[model samples]
Target: MQMSQLVLKTLREAPSEAKARSHQYLLRAGYIRRLSSGIYSYLPLGLRVLAKVSNIVREELDSCGSQEILLPALHPVEIWERSGRIKKMADVLMKVEAKSGDFVLGPTHEEAVIEAVYQDLSSYSDLPATVYQIQTKFRDEPRSRYGLMRTREFIMADAYSFDSDQEGMRSSYSKVYDAYNKIFAKMEIPFEPVEADSGAIGGDVNHEFMSPAEIGEDYYAKCSSCGYRANIEAATRGSKDADAQGVGSELPELLYHYTPEAPGVEKAVEAISDLGVPTKAHEMLKCLVAIDGDQRLVMLLVPGDREARVPSGMRLLEDPEFERYPYLHKGFIGPMNAKENSIYVVADLSVKERSHFATGGNKAGYHVTGAVLGRDFQVDEYRSLVVVRDGDPCPRCGSALTLIRSVEIGHTFQLGLYYSSILENARFTGPDGQQYPYYMGCYGIGVTRLIAVIAEHFLDDRGLIWPVSVSPYQVVVVPLGAARSKEIEEVAETIYSGLLKDNVEALIDDRKLSPGVSLADCDLIGVPYQVVVGSKSLKEGQVEIKVRRDGTTTKMPIEEVPTRIRELLGRSL
Candidate 1:
């Protein structure tokens, strides 16, 4: 590629909407252009990087016996309805009305893949098959920010595996898991594979590959002592035993007091302090009312310093529900009167060990001191209900946990037989003349988001410093005094042609620009290596090879530049 002919224009400043550092650089570097709030177009430079990542993914998955197949982006609505995901994923589903029938832009290909393969894979003989595709996916994302990190339309490499039994499914899953490790390894980014919750995917076991970054939205907890790591939604902490024998065994009375100005936990703490009680946020009990799946009213209790995690299949009480249950005050609800009001009380494990709590008085403008868990308030259950904090004890080894902010780059799921059992004709005939649902697995990699992740991972104050594996071009040849000095242009063209002949991806800066402008542009473009063909270096019978990552320059013969770049790329790979 020649700089004079390349279709890109670097910007002096990023767009006003661009907030993340990588997002700003991507626009300023002329790699991508924004079309709408959550939509973007990749220029030639960006597309090349995407293609390289996709090729690496293909190589790894193909080596593991997985065949590549492109699935349709438009899927029949009936497929999703049959699988019961139409209602579950209603928020993100992009429905379309066509002349033929109703369809949806596919956010995932599980149902479509099953609809295509169920007939051919009807027997156990055709077991343990994996098929994957690199294609575009659409989702009606509510908050798409950070450029490509969260977009409405993006490229994803999603792979699905099918097997006859549990054992076969495990084998297929491990193969894909190993393939994912290799794929990210080649990308040369720092990432950790942690246990994660299968949110809308509906799976038994899943893992998310998280790349730590300041702009990340997801968080995971890692134990320092035992190496136990999991997503914050799925992470667990150590539990303590109850101080008393059982609920309501002791008669620790509650001392009710008036606190007219205290409506929230923070104000309540202040009011308690005025009464000569120095209480921290964690020293106060926080009560939340929610309705379980069974429509049972339940009160969840946790410390004021922590967030209560609403159990799956349950939702917090909304405004109408609060109006319906007038006795449950918004901020003054407590467990002391839960039994009398026929509301079940669930408390965190830490509450059991605590001797006393300053909590709500079951009335507006009031609080109570000397409220004990087992005595003053009987808990129906003690479970892990709070979000894990930084210093929380690890569930495995009781070590302190470290929370890390990260973005999810990839995910693997052991889907089991959920999808096959729900979807029709997704079963195979066994040797005993009986049919069984196919055990399944899913793996996904964000193809376009990786560009942002790589950009954010390898960057400096000047510009992006991409690794050799996914850099837009491995080498950029810049010639100084191209219009005035014929020797410099000749040397640069020779080096660029030789690099191309050696199968190295190289670009020649043929534009007649100053040395500073040319070198700065090369740095901003993030090519790993720069062959500077200056008049002085050409007169010395040498060309300067500048390493973009470390800013190191070495003078070498023009013929040696291509060989040295190939060596560097090989080592980096």
Candidate 2:
């Protein structure tokens, strides 16, 4: 495309709301325009990059024998209700009311896709099938920021696989997993696949492809000894006391003490020590209350040294919620005197090892000095819910754990009959003439978020240095002294036309702009290659080619420039 005819404008400064470096460059480079807080419009240059991403996704999924099918963004409310996700994801689910009834802007297509495919497949003959779609998706993000990294509406490639049996489902899941690795490798981005929680998707086993970044929101722990990596939600630490012989084995008996001002564990330990009580911080139980979906308080007794880890399977209630139950003390709280059957008490598995531990007194200014788990107060159940610490032992090989921030780019779930069993008519007749629910798996790639991810990871001070696979244009021809020298313009245009004829994506700066401005724009736009047609270089029977990634420059014949770029791209034109 001719630069003079295109409606492109480069900005010297990014908008005030831009936080991430990639977002700033994307705006200044004239690739995208913000329409609202979390909504954006792709400019001509941005559209080209998105198109390349879409084509790559299609190629990978197609090669894996997955059929492509587009489902509607607008779905009936009944479908989500039938899948039981209406209540599960009500916060982020965008619901609309029409005169006819209610409709939902689907954040996912599981309910719709299953309902559609289930209607036509009723026999065991169609045992295994896969369908996917690359389309727009919507979610009501409370705080959308960092450009496309967190947006309310964006493009996504979501695929679902259905099989007749568990073995077939496992095979289908592995195939999609393999395809995901290929897809990211083709895009040339560094990534890590970590074990993950299923979340509201209601699946059994899942994995998330995380791209490490300094500004990532997700935190994960990876063990060096066993190579076990998992997102925080799925990460776990063993209970300090899994096996025990007797209660308070090291200590004599359960002792109650009066501590006037100590509320937290650290201060309580200090106050108890001041009173000549000998105890370590780890030999204490931290008590916290969380109201479940039923609005009932569930008490968690975690080891004092570790923070109370609430499982994502249950949501925690807020501070204001404690007002409803006056029996529960805000800071100094425990299960011994939780006020008349109003709370259900549960303890962490780690608590069992602390034979004689300290606990909250349930009364302000009072605490228990020597508390035994089975003797003082009985717990309903013990769970491995301790929050994994930085130096925590690895669950597998007992090595120190490492924490890192990462971005979640892709996720795959073995959705085993969760949606199919819930949704109506999502069943098939087995060879035994009995009806069975379909085993399903879901795979997703954030088509638009990848633009921000690639830019964020593969960037320098100059601007966004995109990978050749996803760069808007592989080559840009910036003719130095274009308006001053007709020969340079003719040579640059001839080269650009030839590159196009050779099926190589190329752009030329035909505008009457200064050489500095043209080159700066080229660098900011981040096309993989830049050809500079300077008069001096032309006089020397050569032109200059700059590699955007490494800033390497090579002087080559005007005729050989396109060939070098194609070779660098490592693909046919």
Candidate 3:
């Protein structure tokens, strides 16, 4: 490619709205332009890089027996309803009303792909098959920010695999995991695979590929000694001792106290101190209501010093169990006198361990002080109900956990008949001809997000230092004084043509620009190898060669430029 014919524009300042370094550099380098809050339009340079990413994905998917197929972005609501996801995925699913009245933009193609496969392939002979696509996905994020990190619309490479049984699913899942490792390796981005919650997907076991970055939105905990890593929501904090048995039953009698204007735990603690209530003698039981539907409310009790932790596996909002009630008060909710079979009370292990505690009196302007847990009240369950914090001991190892912000680039899941059961995607070849639902595994890679992660991990103050595997061009030839002198132009053209003949991707800057301007642009683009044909070097029968990654520059004879560049790129590639 020639700079004279290219519409390349480099910015002096980064965009103000871009919060991430990758986003800022991408916009400033004239690679992409924002169309909306989370939408962007790729320019020529950006498209080249994106195409390279897609090609790598295609090659890896092809190696894993996955046939590339394009699915419809517009899907019927009925298919989603059949899979029981229409209501379960209400928030993130992008729905549209058309002439027929209802539709949805495909955020994922699990339902669509399974439905098609079941309709066409139903025998044991066709039991194991994988299909994938590299396409655009639409997700309706309520708060779309941080550039492309959490986008409302983005490109994703999703692949779904069908197997006859659990054993087959395991094999397929492992195959995809290996392929994903290769894909990330080929892209030259450092990533870590960690256990993750399936979220709305409803699966048994899932793993996420995360790239470490300071500005990432997701927080995951990792053990420094051991390699145990997990998202904070799914992480475990080993165990702690409970002081339930030490305190005597008759230590304090439960008493109701008149207290007003103390709504929160902190304020209540201050009020109790003002009233001269010994802090060590009494515990605090914070009552909260976890309402499912309008008809059911599960009261949750936790220690005042600790907060309630919701399990990631239990997606009550995504489950059909709580579809009827979407609006629930968060801050002002409390456990009053139990209504007629309308509420279920549950207590945390920490709360159950306390002897004397302070709680609501089930009325306005009143509270209970010196309330013993077993004596004053009895609840249903005492389980792990506290959110794990930083410095908490790891469950696998006793090492303290360190929280690191990271971006999710890929995920693999053991679906375990979740979708197959709903869609009736089954096959039979047994002696009794018994039909059983097929097992499934799902894998996804965010192709565009990988680009952003790479830029985030591998860039300097000047611009992106693209890895050799995914760089748009391997070598850039800049001819100084090419517009004024014919010798420099001839030398640069000869060298560029020779590089192309050697199967090396090269770009020539033949624009009517000063040597300093061209060299600055070359560094900004961060092409790995630079061949400079200037009047000074050309007069000495030599050309300047520089490596962008580490500022290594040397003079090479004009005849040796092509061979030297080939040797350099061959070693790096």
* RMSD values, in order shown: 2.9, 3.2, 3.8
Across 1-573, the per-residue lDDT of candidate 3 in tens digits comes to 897777778887877888788888888777788898889888877888889899999999899888898888989999998988988889899889998778899999888887666755566677788889998999999987666677888899999888888899899989889999999988888788888878788788889998888878887889989999987667666644555543474578666665687666776666666777745322677766555435356777777777667654331233353345433223223344433335566766556456667776665556667665555565666655666668877777778889888888999999988887777554445335667777888889988887788888878877788887877789999998636588888899999999999988889998888777788788777678899888898888999999888888999899998788878877876
Lowest-lDDT window of 10 residues in candidate 2?
239-248
User: Candidate 2 regions off by >4 Å?
Assistant: 238-245, 248-253, 257-283, 288-299, 312-346, 362-366, 378-382, 571-573
For all predicted structures, in order, the TM-scores are 0.91, 0.91, 0.89
Candidates ranked by lDDT, best first?
A: 1, 2, 3
For candidate 2, what is the lDDT?
0.84
Which candidate comes out best when scored by lDDT? 1
Better of 2 and 3 by lDDT: 2
Q: For model 1, how does the per-residue alpha-carbon lDDT over 311-340 read when each residue is reduced to its tens digit?
A: 655679997778887787777777898998
Whole-model Cα lDDT per candidate? Answer: 0.88, 0.84, 0.77
Off by over 4 Å in 1: 99-101, 240-251, 255-264, 267-280, 290-298, 321-330, 336-345, 360-369
- Candidate 3 or 2, higher TM-score: 2
